[model samples]
Target: MAVPGHKLDRMFNPEVVAVVGDKGPGYMWLRNNLPFKEKGGRLYSVQLDEKEIPGIEALGIQNFKSMADIPEPIDYALVAVPRQVSPYVLKDLIANKANGAGFFTSGFAETGEELGVKLQTQLTEMAREASFNLVGPNCMGLYLPKVGVRFNADAPVADDGKIGFLSQSGTHGIMFSLVSAANGMHVSRCASFGNAVVLDVSDYLEYLMLDDETEVIGMYVEGVKNGRRFFETLREACKRKPVIVWKGGQTEAGARATMSHTGSLAAPQAVWDGMMRQCGAITTNNLDETIDVMKLLLNAKRPTGTGMALLAQTGGQSVSITDAFSKAGLRVPRFSDGTYTELGEFFNIVGGSFQNPLDMAGTIQGSMDTLDRILRILDADPNVDAMAMELSAMFAARQWKGKPETLDKTIEEIALHKERSKKPFLVILHPAHEAEYVASIQPKFHAANIPLFQSFERAAAAFARVLGGGGRARTRTGVVGLALETQPR
Candidate 1:
């Protein structure tokens, strides 16, 4: 049993930090942007010769010549200087007994250089001896809202507190933040641990499990720091909060390329699949699906074990959603005779027969109204535990004509009214480009605990997955996009 508590406390709640680097955007970025000036986490800047960056307010202390100059007990260090100079920096941190460090400078083993690999090995040895945890020699560290922790112009976690995202690419970490923000997914923290030297994915997983702020966890992986330990952490976290992994650089070809870059060993797909299932982790097909499930798990009710409901305004959508439920291995239970009769009473408008995929348009006119009826019907059905709504805003110029165009606001209201239900509720809006307006609905979904997705198929699949005992909890959801995030203009 790896104890992650002591390591996590030193990282997130660090009281003093030493950032070593040349005059570059990375170091200056932190100085100008860190929100911790008020958190009392003292920051010390280190450079070989240069001093006095242009915009920083004078802290009155001269730029430290070395780690020894800083008399304070440094909790964390960021080695962002040139790669050639990194080993020395790591040595300094170790000598000072720094709690941990996020080594953002690349060009080590990842560069495929013999000397670079040697550098990483030596630094790892030094770190182990010093008893300090390390995140990356070529990565971004972690994000924690509770302690005012973040990187310079990095980590775009929304202000809401719903999930935590961890990735191996700092780029993915930053992009996930922005996409999560655009989609309205609030997060407790997001970390991009590149080239893990000491602390790796498993370490973060253990920490997030104990983190009261996170309800779910999302990961984008180029490599796992330790596979066995990772599975151990995943097993425990899945029992608590849902864990979703997007195994990037996943193919054999891509994995081979990874070894040269970071000496990483990508696992086989079959092995990965069985591992995820045993630990109860939801493995995604791609980056898109990964983010889709992450946001939705934040909204799903609970891992209910087998049925679903499909609600759409049009028969075509109903047909597609029904097919999706079937393919996902979930049953769309036909409405009970009594339930059918009650819905039939309103058949004057909804002429279609009331079935599992109820095209309830007669009495339900708007997105809000349609969803309301669907919710009532599904809630009453013990067999139907989850639902998928195919929504194409009538106002969306490309799809429908009657859309209130105000569907975002209307959807917001419905969620607010149904805030208490834990059943998996999802709406898949057809692809469109009115980004700003469509994206506006995100905050409300997060607020109401219902998840909104851009792909109808993903929305349906997520519902089936959770209800079929293949996914985690229910009701509210979100999407952290990588490419084609269904951005609202």
Candidate 2:
């Protein structure tokens, strides 16, 4: 599907790309790092410097003396030239009929200088006249792995991914892309539309809605070009797919920083909250929470109701999980007599509580035999809409340090239960051991499509978010539908 206001093909899947101002070491490093040359997209180094530019020829990039001298159609240009000469370089690019341009050079509106602002305006105006999009005057630019385009050298390039990310800050965009990859959420496209002179957040959201590859969108927005249009677009996108927003510039000091950083007028926190609530979009304050929310959407089943049945190894953790769920407006209801009778067969009353937020100290510590039965029972229970289990894999690893086989068996059981369970199941893995231990088990859990978190609070919060702001327990009527509008506060 064709995206509006931006020919994303040229913006991302360009046939031929030119990197202007390739004289310096920075551009050389970037050119060396671009992995797309071997992956179908042809790359060219446009350098006016006839002098010997070190390390240019070795990369096998087609070098050109000028934009017009390239002698081929230029789909997109990454202009890294100085602010003073950017206009002239852009003019040359337009003359060559380049479809889109991403200005990696800063010193535009962000500099708070009239000349910089004027130059930025001129560039966008020229792009508009040319009937293509201007991505940024101060950004890292696109990272669409499907077509072999990326801004950072080390960013992961997946054949296909589901996340569609758009960020106002270039650094934040890189962070989200990398972090999402680490958490097993692959990104389809990431655009850092710095200063957003031409293509803003609203346009990107619309494009993501139409893109078949994107199932979820994670946005890092500081400001918007049009508030009403953005809100309406956000509402529409939410109806189609999950839209996770991380609005920076919430504090007074942060607002000042955002203005200087992206030349954006950060809206008030109250207004931002209202928009998110009205649009049925999830709010993530930081990158970790963003990943947390995305992980829930990608891995877990959409909840039919807010009734949660938490099973924890430790009594303290059980209490904490219940508190967190309560604070988030989710319910931790009592188990039915039938469930209690069945649970009694495996759980000896000596060490655990069978009530809601079931403390499975004895069962967790002793028996792996009852694990599947426990999961199946919880899933079948009419009172339990969702389930959360705290598994201390790190502690278990420590106890069975030499027995990697035992650990694997335990994880395998959890994975098997996750596949068979009808209700949404959340596994909270407490990283109580060294980084290596946690790392070893994370991939296994991720492989099983089980949502894993380091703490109960985070897990509970994710469950609550899935429950649409969780309140009193609601019965599982059917598959939970997406929240179409914000419930009044």
Candidate 3:
């Protein structure tokens, strides 16, 4: 196979891969159950010591010690060997011109010892010389839906190409994948560069920016290994794709050791704030929004700025959303009298409630058509930047029950109405036995870029990061299936 200059891509998106590990009980299960090998990806098991694991011989297992012996130049390699032994095996890879590698082995630089640091530095130097991009020095590696490449060592998820995720921690990567699947967000590319040795978060990010399989790029960072490079990547990424980040270890201890993690320079609060302001990067302190922002950007169009109109089945949900948005520096952007009259009683269109939160389109039960029209009108009016949609099960009760298609059609109508106006919209649904409810609405609202948030907090945090205007949002067109439009509704 032709070797591309960038190898991390193969690890994240590989058609052929080799797992260089002992065929133990766990490794065997990983081979059979993990997403990558199951997708009929060309796989080879390079067994060294035990030699004879059941069924290994049939799948083209060779006594071959390294990539040189395989005859086939592999695109990706998962190094799950022991911590002490991994460096030696990785050298063999560098010798053979291996494109990219993922280190599942732990106990490296994280140990914070001099020898460990030396070991990490050596690997980084080797990777540069060999031209092999690396993803994890201590990560679970990457998980991709299309190629079935998963290092999660767990269950399969509904593969929708929406958010392109990158993490500096493997555990966090797994958490995001599982939670994203739970929240009706699908994964296209998920990579965790544990102790990002040669290719840290920024390298994979650069690749994702050019990748067609990604849409929204998300990152989790303990510290950026290279601040200048990271800044450049973040600025570029935010312009094209929405980049949401969660900065880990923000306390004093973390600040002290920032240099050790990624050679990061701990800036004073004012400097850090100024840096983020210059870049388009949306940095978050919250973990939930760390994953949520990517999902939000994946589902929703960018609002014309944070001016919004609130719509809800219940008054309280509206108030909550309103208060939060206002606190986040977003505006309800006062409504016109004609706009208030439109919802009628839904806003109590007659009473004093005719405010930006619109209090009562004055009606108790909102018709699907009425709801759709009202949302579209607010979205259309120049007064609002986006609509704060608070949906409850009660809104769907009288009209949307039994007729499952009714809900779909109603959502479709709302989405279609918002489409022509090209305005961003938000959906806040009450939670209760919601795994399936979220799953059901996913396919419908996907194309429209409306992320149905798991929690309002997640939504608010993510929204603030994007619209804060301090950091630019980046878009990745190279991501393969960003637009998940199932047509003919």
Give the best candidate by TM-score: 2
Q: In model 1, which regions exceed 4 Å deviation?
A: 1-5, 22-28, 31-33, 51-62, 152-160, 349-353, 367-374, 395-409, 420-422, 433-436, 467-489
Q: Model 2, which residues run further than 4 Å from truth?
A: 1-6, 23-29, 52-54, 365-367, 469-489
lDDT of 3 by residue, 18-106 (tens): 77774654455245324555567777666666544454655444335555777767777777787767778788777766677778876
Query: Please, what are the lDDT tens digits per residue for candidate 2 over residues 330-433?
Result: 88888888998898877766768878888886776645777777878788888988888887664676665777677677778877787777778888887775
For candidate 1, lDDT tens digit of each residue in 241-326?
Answer: 77887776568898887776555667666666566666667777566676677666666556464567777766777788788768
Instruction: State the TM-score for model 1.
Output: 0.85
lDDT of each: 0.66, 0.78, 0.65
lDDT of 2 at 8: 65
Best by lDDT, which number?
2
Q: How big is the positional error of residue 481 in model 3, measured in Å on the Cα after superposition?
A: 34
What is candidate 2's CA lDDT for residue 270? 78
Off-target runs (Cα >4 Å) in candidate 3 are 1-13, 32-35, 55-68, 155-160, 254-270, 341-354, 361-366, 394-406, 432-449, 454-457, 470-489
Candidates in order, TM-scores: namely 0.85, 0.91, 0.82
For each of the candidates, give the backbone clash count: 24, 1, 41
Output the better candidate (1/2) by lDDT: 2
Question: Higher TM-score: candidate 1 or 2?
Answer: 2
